[model samples]
Target: MASLKTTLVAATILVAVAGCAKKRPADLPPPPVDNSGPVDQGGATGPTTGAVVPGSDADFRRSVTSNTVRFGLDQYDIDPEARAILDSQSAWLQRYPNVRITIEGHCDERGTREYNLALGDRRANAAKNYLAARGVSPDRMTVISYGKERPEAMGSDDASWAQNRRAVTIVLS
Candidate 1:
């Protein structure tokens, strides 16, 4: 009778263990295999997930032109319009893996020298942050603060100041 009880207990434990086995998630799909043609990487694998492949010369040029981001003046905040531009830029960057950009920060001549410098930094960083928010790789973007040094419009008025207080996106070759 004791042997029978022991065998039944063991069987129960085995059944419980089998029942507890993990099941695959219902939402997961099978890996996409490209078996129709030759493998991309010499029978290895294509680019990994979230991996950016280099772009061609034409692609780079298109990225440079299409991903240009502009900014507002006296404020380093990313606005809705700027966000829309950045979103397009992010798509362009993703499409052209070989593209990288530098966000140059500038300030108008209204503020003090040091204040302008800091504000320029803030503007540049803000632009980069916007791009990053839109899925552009942080590694592919750089920031530089010109601080009222390089003015697009050389006038000392509000119009020129507004133009000068800008973040220009430059493409890196």
Candidate 2:
């Protein structure tokens, strides 16, 4: 009977320890949003026009030349994907003289607020430099860092962090 009690106690302790050892996974990124409208699919209306967007089936050149390209985590470095997208963006900027864009940088919730802010700025500046190097006027680009304040994804996992660490381009009026 004493042996049975010990065994029971041991099993109970094991269960408790196992329960405590379990880990929680971070939230994941959501499905892509359907960003339709005349403007999103390489087509634009009003004011600006005649910009080309590669890989788009729109009937005509987009009116404005604002294209957003996403990037990887912990990296302010511009990757091949980003470069291809920027190349297309540069073509558009070259076609249109008066268009200007703002690069908004964002980071995940893993770092300190100030650190994230600076990191975000670095990311934005990295993108800005790339655009400038591509022959876009330095005066035509602006950079803003949102750090962790604005999230493209709210998950605590790598997937969410990947989504969060991005530089988005918004057209400036």
Candidate 3:
């Protein structure tokens, strides 16, 4: 009888343990996470959000021209071309009040890392200020300096370097 009782107790504990086992939801997928550096949505490789779903980044890029403005060598000034782009961007931002963005500043691979980072920061702020002056709320925009870390064009040549020296606006949902 004692043996049977012990067996029943063990069975009850097993059942309890089995009942308490974690059951993961089958319908929901895990949130997106990038192990490498900052999370980038709808990157140069294209949208990674979903197969058919149109991503916010894609939409923003389409609505707003190139989403990028080139800077002169070692310069953070916004030229007439850059000003025109910013004007259009401001109009788009006004249309989508809820959308927030981050202006990424980049530099050519010529200056020291520290100097490039500082220059990149200045470039980012220049773009942000331009937008703010054009009526886009400063609260909706943020600036980040990639410096020469993430270059659009890879090469030591002037053409590639020119491409690298730019500020790009990315949608942050």
Compare the candidates by lDDT and give the number of the best one.
Answer: 3
Clashing pairs in 1: 55-98
Two-way lDDT contest, 1 vs 2, winner: 2
Worst 10 residues of 1 by lDDT: 30-39
lDDT of 2 at 122: 90
Model 3 misplacement above 4 A = 1-55
Weakest 10 consecutive residues of candidate 3 by summed lDDT: 30-39
Q: What residue pairs clash in candidate 3, if any at all? A: none
In order, the Cα lDDT scores of the candidates are 0.67, 0.71, 0.81
Candidate 3 lDDT by residue in tens digits, 103-159: 889899998999999999999999999999989899999888878988888899999
What TM-score does model 1 achieve against the real structure? 0.60
The local distance difference test score of model 3 is 0.81
Model 2: per-residue Cα lDDT over 1-173, one tens digit each = 99999999999999999989958888653333223455444243223655534324232124323355566666788888888877777776677667777778889898899999998899889888998998989898888888888887778998988888877766543
